[model samples]
Target: MPDIKDPLFQPYSLGSLQLPNRVVMPPMTRSRASQPGDVPNALMAEYYAQRASAGLIVSEGTWISPLGKGYAWTPGIHTPAQVAGWRQVTEAVHAACGRIYAQLWHVGRLSHTSLLGGQAPVSSSAIQAEGVNVFVAENDGTPGFVQASRPRALDKAEIRAIVDEYRQASRNAVAAGFDGVELHAANGYLANQFIDSNANDRTDEYGGSLENRLRFLDEVARALVEGVGDASRVGIRLAPLTTLNGCADADPETTYLAAAKLLGEIGVGYLHIAEADWDDAPLMPVAFKERLRTAFPGTLIYAGHYTAERAREAVARGWADLIGFGRPFVANPDLPERLRIGAPLNEHDRATLFGGEARGLIDYPALEAAEA
Candidate 1:
């Protein structure tokens, strides 16, 4: 019998949505979208439906426009074809009684010219990201990682245009039957390029002072809220400490606390924090977590290298309202049940993690099938 007493199994209400458990399948870029159009397809739908047991599922980071794309073979939420493609995925998840949120993404300077039709990527400033490589298709159509291209700073008008794209993406997500939309503000993406001090050196209103640096985020969040027509259907992800893709803030706590407070005032439904998960990464101080909890009066989710025991402890300590399992969900479709009954998890195949066919995408067996 399952342990009903597990905290992860407790039902929680997130705005108007009631989650069956506290386990979340955080967004993971599978890079398996159909080629030539970057559209979600039947294989992707089956992959998500197989893992519909998660209390909440945040779909892979989806570009809001062709310019927002950084990686090869990822899905987009910008066009009619993309929207229709996602509708199939959402319908499949809903059929299995799962709730999903589309993660709106823009990679900013973390993109290569090949992916941008030879156009330089855009960022808060004309700075190129170092020590990070983005996936792209080479001349022979072979996909590989390449250094990010130099980016041109966006002028005021272009900035507004991208913001408008995000707004439309949010509406598209709803039209496609997503339960809500999550702004991909974390992972050193476009929003992070504007928020992080090291990345945004522009002296314009979108850069410099902390509030100034956050202006872009604020505008984008408001746009998302307005586009969704409900603040309760919008969430923002932030990575205060992570320097992923060469973006870092002078003081993550202060920057993120202010970001959280701003989102709170805007009344976004929740805040998802992506902790530094890399080996030897700095641990996010407990004090900062507590302060964030106080600043944002909404559902809080933390993801990164969390075990079931740690997840329960975080909930018990009031540090997190929910937990997101990343790679675990990749290999174990029934991750929640496995964690609930202390079942061993299947190891994910790292080589097959990126663009691939159904082998590593949806071939993982459920507990019942494994036992049988």
Candidate 2:
């Protein structure tokens, strides 16, 4: 084959690290973490190591505390066992010469009482996400999902504690041997719930206007930086125009643009935008993307139904610094290599997308193995 000079293969610099390609493995919840303690294990380690060829690996969203969990079998970073469990995962990825970032997450109101010790979910407001649901373990040891419970608005004290939890999680991530950490502020999670006006009805300092709504996000970013002691190792994911998990704002463009500028000023390493991924999902306007490119001075990464051709075009236009592949990385461990060589990709099996063993996680055949 002739030499492939794709921009996706070109090296790029993100903060203090240099990337070999612009392909990123974005955070995807497989719901396969070890049960009982929601700890990372050798299975998760092998799964990530198999896809270490990506320019960057953003680990699945990890709950920072018991209250942060919204799903069954997802990992956490708060406890000693959980930290040690992640140590093995980080070691495995590093052994393969891969760079990985831990995505710190708190699901907030998008949770069930069953998942939260029968306690009401907490959010910026008392409103429950109308149609949102969370995965939980059933009596038979099988995974099942339940609708989110009505949430109580968090007071200032509780909000402060949550910020501290984020800081602690960042410290734990470093101790666990991660290269960096990404704040899960997207997809109507806690941070996004705070950002979206409809979900946040507080009249206090944390609510009312745009600046107030952005306060939580700012505090979390600052806390992560303080914990990691370096803004270069910190990244954040946002969903500006997404209504996923029932998060919607009247003026999404303005709300997110201000946030982009604020994050840029904070000197974060990168800004990841998770565009609506479902089929018939609202398309992210080009004008908004252009504005985002200008507003956020750090490296920009975008994910959502991207193809090789579309990714190439995105980079060619200076729109994205990296293209995150969620499902592609799931089915193609050696996705960057396959893209480079124009090899056929393995189709993802939706049946095994979540809560499975190695059948769909680490067993995807690489091109070399497939040909052999």
Task: Give the top-scoring candidate (lDDT).
Answer: 1
TM-scores of the models, in the given order?
0.98, 0.98
Query: Candidate 2: which pairs clash?
Result: none
Residue pairs clashing in model 1 are none
lDDT by candidate, in order shown: 0.94, 0.92
> Candidate 1: where is the Cα deviation over 4 Å?
1-4
Q: Please give the distance, in angstroms, between residue 210's alpha carbon in candidate 1 and its true position after superposition.
A: 0.7
lDDT of 1 at 248: 90
- Residue 115 accuracy (lDDT) in model 1: 92
Query: Which ranges in model 2 have alpha carbons more than 4 Å from their true place?
Result: 1-4
